[model samples]
Target: MADENQGFMGAVWETIKTIFWALIIAGVFRTLFFQPFWIPSSSMKDTLLVGDFLFVNKMAYGYSYASCPNIKIARFGIDIDADDICGFLDGDNTRVLAGEPERGDVVVFRHPVTHQDYIKRLIGLPGDRVQVKEGLIYINDEPVKVEDGGTFTEVKEAQGPERRFPRCSNDPVGEGGQCVKERQIETLPNGVTHSTLNITDRGDLDTTKVFTVPEGEYFFMGDNRDNSTDSRVAQTSFGVGFVPYENLIGRADRIMFSSAGRSMLFFWTWRSDRFFKGIE
Candidate 1:
């Protein structure tokens, strides 16, 4: 009886160790190479939909200290704070052999004011004069070539907490209402083309003053024009404006998986068409 009890306890201990090591390895890989992110809003609409799960490549953009999590915090490694970590830390210029963000790259960064995670397309780079006039984007005084892609209608139901999202909706008018939007393909100066949705040609953000992206700052905007509160809004107004280089976390590489968000156990809501889809 004693021998059986000891064997059972040893087996449990071994299982626990195995799980712990597996989690540690996974966490290290996620931290160093890629991080998974979910689209929770309609800001990116036609490009990246709600419930889309994507992998952000950490190595694509150079890493700051804030991008690297403290491994010591997990109690798996030794603690070594460069600036004396006291339960909180700020951005430190710690480049770990990575590249810089480029124009038209979809990036994830920490919000300059809220410190929350946000993903948007990199628009105006350093010193770029960006402006939106009558629903058209002009970079450096040259209008971005935009071609009509026809109309887009959202026919799906909202899932998770996004059901309460009071932005552009599938049922725009009301229940059983038609949600129609104008679709257009906008080509950036770098030739990176992505589709955009416009509820109307004349919306609040559709007309804006020329934004001169300052040095060491990048401007970001959502593909869902008229709906997103991005670089178009003032930073002091609680909107993301001219994100610093240090705030960038990574570049969104591809969509790993996506769901319709009706149910987790129900497999019918899975967006199989988006599985392993590459993000443009």
Candidate 2:
């Protein structure tokens, strides 16, 4: 009986050790290489969907305080933010072994004030003047090229875990009906082109004052121009303003998986085409 009990206890210890090591390795991997992200809104529209799942390439722009993983489990009463792990690196707005991010790059960063993670396209770099006029973007007094790309359509139904309904240019859409938004292809000064969606002809953000991006900061905007509350709005208003360099977490390069249902276990809702789909 003693031999049998000893053997069982030995197995339990081995299992516990294995799990502990596995978690340690995963934490290191997530901090140094890639961190998984899920799209929870339509801000990026056709580029990223509500259920799109992708890994942020942490090495794409090197490491910063924002590179540290923010773990928050309310039920467990656990809340660990980036500052908790790398507070010493904060406030400097610098990154170790950093590479410059180009205009039009889709990036994920921590909100300057709230410290919450947000994903958007980099629009203005340091010392650039950015503005939106009549739903068109202008950089340093010159407008970027915008070409009509037709309409983007989706079902007018609650989506994802949030159960949020998509805003549409053609409103009054009944549930299960087709919701549409006008799509336009925008080309930045660097010649990078991406699709932007318009839900209304006149949106509050369609026309805004020229915002001069300060040095060591960046301006970002959502692809869903009308629906996004981005750099166009001030951070004090609960919108993402100019993000500091240290706040940038990483770049999003591709979608590894996606699901349209509330739970990922609902295999029938999986989007097969989005598997390994590269983000442009």
Give the winner by TM-score: 2
Per-residue lDDT for 148-242 in model 2, tens only? Answer: 99999999999999999999888899999999999999999999999999998678899999999999999999998888878999886498889
Model 2: worst 10 consecutive residues (lDDT sum): 232-241
For candidate 1, report its TM-score. Answer: 0.86
Clashing residue pairs in candidate 2 (N, C-alpha, C atoms within 3 angstroms):
none
> Lowest-lDDT window of 10 residues in candidate 1?
80-89
Question: lDDT tens digits, residues 1-280, model 1?
Answer: 9999999999999999999999989877876788778888888888888888898888887666436543345566686432233223355433557577888999998777666678999999999999999999999999999999987876534554457343443334664355678889999999999999887765788889999999878999999987787999889537888988877779998898888764445578788999999888
Candidate 2 lDDT? 0.93
